[model samples]
Target: MTAPRFLQIHWLASYPGTLINRDDSGLAKRLPFGDAVRTRISSQCLKRHWRTVEDDWALNQIGPEMAVRSREVPEYRVLPALEAEGVATDEIRKAVVLALAQALYGDKAEDVSKRQALLLGEPEIRYLISKVSEIAAAAADAKSAGEAVKTAFKEEKANLSSMRKNGVLEAGLESALFGRMVTSDRAANTDAAIHVAHALTVHAEQGESDYFTVVDDLARDAGESGAGGIFDTELTAGLFYGYVVVDLALLKSNLGGDGALAGKVCEHLVHLIATVSPGAKKGGTAPYAFAEALVVEAGSRQPRTLANAFRQPTAARSEAAAAALAAHLSSVDEAYGAHEKRHHLSLQPIEVPNSSRIGLDGLGKFASAMASA
Candidate 1:
């Protein structure tokens, strides 16, 4: 039997890095599946651009300015509540700090009716904006990321379903099948990818062998220490998880073929993810290593082209400009698809033992402690 066609995905920006101060509109940048610099859209970027948090402790009040005058607001109320409960003043203050953070970043929904009216005054833009907001709001409401995606699909079933059925169609407003063009802001996208590219290049320039092992070690360190605050590792991990789900949702809705196409999609995703990491070396053996391996297993020597430029941004739809890229993405997609064997090196799930203090100790006591707790 053929291996299951689940998407093997990793967030392109899940690895940690210091956020460089730049006067750029895009959040992050990285190299594309091919050799081109493309904007990196991380889970952090998506969440920051959208997502709302619900703060249970914060007082749901009037406007912020009006909230300042109220003694019941978090800045005042939480502290007294803790103090009265005999909590230390310093501890109360720190808890309050966390509370404020929750107020801003937690998954609470705000009444956007008034603001929506003001910003999206035009009916057409308002409709699209409303749909987009609905997608974000529903995703935020669900407890798990998967639930959030389910919520999003439930809300926008018709549109997303259509996109899945038809690969990607661009036409006039009335004739257009998929109205939401993700790449409309081509310049912005390129700029974003460039930032990710610069960071990756800097890492590559340092010169290293054992690229995968070295990067994985760094990723592990960053994750354990929470040094990946800029990248927001956990959330990014969840977001990439959602992206795969979204892809599958599309495939299912489209009612696409389930044979070799399934295997190909899985292979492409795995290879794409391996190379998308922060420190994937650009030269020598690593260049098309994963793709080459996949092609060899599939027993095809197809000459694939990719949209790769020498570390710079380009116009998306420019006929002459996009030709190289369009060719590349096509071949890359196909070459990955042709692989026959199960791509074992794709993704290995890391099991986290359930214990107060994790690792080997957590392994044996996990069940017992959970039962007792």
Candidate 2:
């Protein structure tokens, strides 16, 4: 087998105030790491942020090619497309159910009002619409349209197979990167090319509770009580470490071997991670922050994470965390020989001895370098 080609992105971000990725009891998320409690943000939360960025990018960059994850595919997408094609209302409705069942559930799908929500990329949607339209055109009535849709399944099986083989059904950037799972049709599932780790604070710190009161201006004007509500919330402040790995080869394959598209994805992903802040109590705390330091590594070798550098938490306000991570990476490379190309970019001035350091202004250049790698 060919060696795995991967891109690993690591960063440190510092934030202040109460950002609650809460647990069952409504406290900030925390986990025990390296014999100390560290604030935690789930991978799911991180992925949600990244996916949202991806969605926005898709809308603005490639609107027609964007995929939507929803169960109302028929009502929202298929029906609208068929209607636009001047298909009768009744014919459109019948075609919607039949087409969805045929495309999603194959021969096993029954006539149902709703199907499970799944990621349907633009290519898949277009294909489904074309098939449904063809069936609708051949039928004399709605019932006949439904029957034609069902009969066309076996007749068009070869076409479906070819589409899958050509990766035509997996064209959207989000689907290609994040992957999709169709339990009803295993062949439609695409393996995820990206993996993100749970973000953790570089220093061990307990969350602090802040007690405050909310005063109502209207009540004050009406000569009411001084305070309207009083509540307490837990917050944490520290430098956080985040790590993500993307398999370049798998990503290319997922995008149907379009190198240019893969490059765009790589560039966008890096930009997103460096700029986007994960979800939190933004309305109250507004702990909006970006990555302070970013390290990107790309190569055809096994990927490694620099998380171990934080086994011993650094000072809260010191640059020791970033320094220690750089040192650790350098040490590893010295001992084992370098297998990947590394690039470092920072918002602050700090010397990472062995790495070619770039300023924030060069972020796009850094992303371009990684994509080229």
Candidate 3:
């Protein structure tokens, strides 16, 4: 079997009375579609919800080391490791850390460097700490310790450059999957292996402001009629259509050609996108809802969105949205002649001309076919 180059996941989730994503203006995010404005959720919000969840499907389980994004890596990670290596002089440690931080970030103090956050893998941090320790141990005082960092980096510039991709990872598992951009070192940048599209409602924005008041127990005890505070929050309800595309080859390469790990990651990702909710007001709104319908496609052709099916907006229901999706797929197939293998998992049946219906577990098996190839 020819390994598929891309695996695209499409789903329809119904979230009622929950503002999944909002704007700085304290309103539900909106997208202007063909004739109406639709409630929207940003890809960044979805990715953050997916990546940071410490659950059975967490991405952290995909590897031995995880990545930490912070600007104080030199001060926190590097200094601690150096201190343990008998670099007892506080002046030397602080001076060396400042120099290293400036190099990693820029030629600025801690305040400036604090603005530039970098995602560095634990392994990468360990490497940096070891190198910094070596320089610090050789220096006689803080002045020399600071200069030694610059001199060491200059002398080992060629060797340091290889750190960009020597281990086949830009930094760590998260970096390999989501990617990283280091302005100070352009060579360290890694392209994202997964691409996500912002989720948009299949219909025009369905939202309202919920006016609420908090009662003051003390005031009530004193027979007061006024509330402690009054506020209103935006709430939205609709069937959102979300899309995520995994570049198989790039994923395997990022994980050091471990197709098995990539396959496992793909399995967990499919489950998360289908089951996880990105709702904002969880406690009050209880925005817990799973995908009503999911469609997975594996193909070699360029990945395209089926969002146009709702260009004019569908009824505010899952069945209507799923039907619209299937019809659009059929039309696309009639024109392009169905170049991909597709599978469906849903509460209601959806028929794509050349597609197979599968259970949720079957979704993983279908995508994991790349591992065998």
Give the candidate number with the greatest lDDT.
3
Residues 143-230, candidate 2: write the lDDT tens digits. 7677667666656554333467757434455667877777645667778888889888888975788899999999999998878899
Candidate 3 per-residue lDDT over residues 1-373, each given as its tens digit: 3788999999999998998888999798999988889999999899888888788878787664778888888877888887787774989998899888877887775685345788887778878888888878888999999998877766665333367556546387778778888776666777898899999999999988899999999999999999999999999899999999999999888888888888988888888898888878788999888899888889888999999999988999888998899999889999998988888788887675688888888987777775334
Question: Each model's TM-score, in the order given?
Answer: 0.21, 0.81, 0.93
Candidate 2 residue pairs that clash: none
Best by TM-score: 3
- How would the candidate models be sorted by lDDT, starting from the highest? 3, 2, 1
Worst 10 contiguous positions by lDDT, candidate 2: 55-64
lDDT of prediction 2: 0.72
Better of 1 and 2 by lDDT: 2
- Candidate 1, residue 178: Cα displacement in angstroms equals 12
lDDT of each: 0.26, 0.72, 0.83
TM-score of 2: 0.81
Q: Local error of candidate 3 at 296, Å?
A: 0.8
Query: Which model, 2 or 3, shows the larger TM-score?
Result: 3
Judged by lDDT against the true structure, how good is candidate 3?
0.83
Clashes within 3 Å, all models in order: 19, 0, 0
- Cα displacement (angstroms), candidate 1, residue 177, comes to 15
